[model samples]
Target: MADRKEQDALIQQPDAEAEAEPEPEPEQLTGCGASALCDPRRKPHRFLVLMLMCSLSFGSYFCYDIPAALQTQIKQDMKVNSAQFMQLYAWYSWPNVILCFIGGFLIDRIFGIRLGTIIFSCFVVVGQVLFSFGALLNKYWLMEAARFVFGIGGESLAVAQNTYAVLWFKGRELNLVFGLQLSMARLGSTVNMNIMGPVYDAVERYIGVESYYCLGITFFIGGVTCLFSLACGLILGYLDKRAERILHRKSHGTEKVIKLSDVRYFPLSLWMIVMVCVFYYVAVFPFIGLGKVFFEEKFDFSPTHASAVNSIVYILSAPLSPFFGLIVDLVGKNLMWVLLAVSTTLGSHCLLAFTFWNPWIAMVIMGCSYSMLACSLWPLVAFVVEPHQLGTAYGCMQSIQNLGLAVVSLGSGAILDMSGYFMLELFFCACLCVALIFALLLYLINLFQGGKLNLSTRERRKLEDQSRS
Candidate 1:
């Protein structure tokens, strides 16, 4: 025991030396990011900013799912097929493949987050407006084009959102905060899914369901959600700017100017992060895009019932994620949680594909897995990279994720056209298996090369300081 103590002391000696050296301190805001350096009794209005961040994408989330919920009606009314309906997601994701990364670069290098948020929010508004009008006019290509525009904004806005999360809550309960944000977003999706059909039925009662105008008007009502998000984005921008000026968030000599060269410097862990994100999402979201139809066909559900059943994933996620995030924060095994989440998700897909279980049970299980993964997954990125690079890293990841969404989304729809929904589920299983492999690989990598990622923010930062020295 004495020898063990000596060995421990020897191990901590270098850490002691590193602590003596000055390092770039992590962000610390007293009184909730206001200038309350003297008063440390309470947190600042950071939670208020968190609320803004949560609502920042509410509109996008609301509108994004409407198409999915209204998929059957759209195909029937427009005489479109599954593949053509899926093209909406493809159009939204394809432009973001490059643009999201560029927007992130601009945020890191030139535009800064405030400008990026507003610019992206504007694109969201205009694209949604265009989409609404295109639907009204029954111009399918126009709707696709508008979705493309919305994609551009959506991806960048996501990067901005991640940037804000790290900026305010980096060393705090970041996982909890991210989970809460996702909960808010998922709530929007859930609400959109549930409301769209009922609202459409009501609107059709008044306006008559014969024309594309009704579809367009129904979508336009959802598009208004984005306008509300845009307002919150503006408010967030003003508040962020004020905080930056007042809080002096960025430390001198710690400012990093992002360049094309730095892109090459991202570590292997980051690539794995990208890989996992791409594969996991290609499995998850594209499935959601087509889920309503799947439930209707395979489960023998009515259209309204099918939409509600499919939305069960989002519905449960809205309330469950914050607790899952808190669990992640407390347990400090984010990677393990992520792995389990994916594994369970894979199980849910399998149950749907193979078993005769009630689809609602499978969906609720999937929903819990979704929330669990949501809390554990994104917060891992903040650990892998520095604050300055968070935007670029998230951007790059979003871009890659978009690529997956675009290609797999189209392919999934095409497979549904050629093979059927069961085959599509198999494909999702395949993608998620790949994601699971990446997660396992990440755990092994971190285990062998210093397991900083699973540590709390304070512990991780301290270890980072020691390693830098």
Candidate 2:
């Protein structure tokens, strides 16, 4: 009887053990069963995510490029000159410079992505409404006010998109993601060129050319686009929170807060690099904003033709930027990127200043120059700033860069107004000269700082040990 009872107990023990084992969670089961399961810390479906994010970014930046394409019609309707047309661009930049840091800080300290994105989207919608109303009524002040407000939203969106990229892609894929995002933004410029004319023509056919209804329709479309992006951002934020919860459960409360001040110890050479970015962008961005007009006035091209030519700059940039990023990753030195950018920019300006007789030649050179600078400058941001402070650092850098754009746009507008000719071409050459000088300064700073613009943790520790020795 005792042996029988013992056998039964032993048999029951195995069944109990089987019952006690917990079932795997749905995510774990699904992820394990499928080859496509994304390990959050590892490379997952990042390429796909990058594509989606880039598309969203492209949608947002469409607003930026629209004003430039619509400038001709706006000027005709508003009875504004080239200088006032230029101010429209400056209005877009100045508020971004003022609000970018605040936006960054808000992203970092207060609103974790989900709320920030939605709020910024609302700002974009409101701005678009104001702009549309202003255009419909031909109210210049209202248009300027709307543009300035839109700049804040645009800056916030820029930081948010960059933050999203950094969070999803780390180490090996970072530069590629940055390059791709930039390319997509350029694609927004392309889309503007492609759509603006067709949209305007359709509106004119329906409502007559004198109605100004086209601008309103365009703004409404932009607002709708922002709403779609906001919806996506909200979904992403929800998924991210769920992921964070899972990570927390797995780690058992081991996460720590990332300190912002840790990034301040970056080498002086990096600051010099930032300065170069500022000057380089200042030199180039205003020209980009005003490129169509400059080409129209100087080369006797129509607005559509001028826009087609200027679009080449961004089109060339879109394809070449990724290659430049790949090269930088392969070569493992940012200085090469810097040197190439400087050379191309200098050459382009020289061509523009000296070879005005051949507009096609000038266009090609300008396109190449713009491509080089864009590819080189954007990726360098990751190397210069700490990962945690990336949003803030990028914001500050953008603020400074936008300041340059604003000043150049305003000053050049004044110059054109005073001189009764497009001095933007000459101004572009002078700005490039400043950029070249700063690029040289950056190289010198790197040389002085032991030929290392950035140091790894191990290298920094080694230097500290040597200092102690």
Best by lDDT: 1
| Model 2, residue pairs in steric clash | none
Candidate topping TM-score: 1
Report how far off residue 405 is in candidate 2 (Å). 1.4
Q: How large is the C-alpha RMSD of every model relative to the true structure?
A: 7.1, 10.8
- Estimated TM-score for each candidate: 0.89, 0.83
lDDT of 1 by residue, 274-306 (tens): 898898889888898999878878879988888
The whole-model lDDT of each prediction reads: 0.82, 0.65
**Candidate 2, position 375, lDDT:** 53
Give the per-residue lDDT digits (tens) of candidate 2, residues 1-469: 2111211222112234434655335344244523443543334544546666676566567777777777777777778887788787788789878677667656665675556666776677677778878877768899889888878787777877777666655445555667777788787777776677678777878877454666766666655666666666666665455554433323221122234564467556556666777777766666666677777877789877888887776777687667766655455456656666777776776676666766666667666666656655665665556444556666776777777777778887778678733355677667667777777777777667675443433554466466545
* Candidate 2 local Cα displacement, residue 251, angstroms: 4.6
Q: What stretches of model 1 exceed 4 Å from their correct place?
A: 1-44, 250-253, 456-469
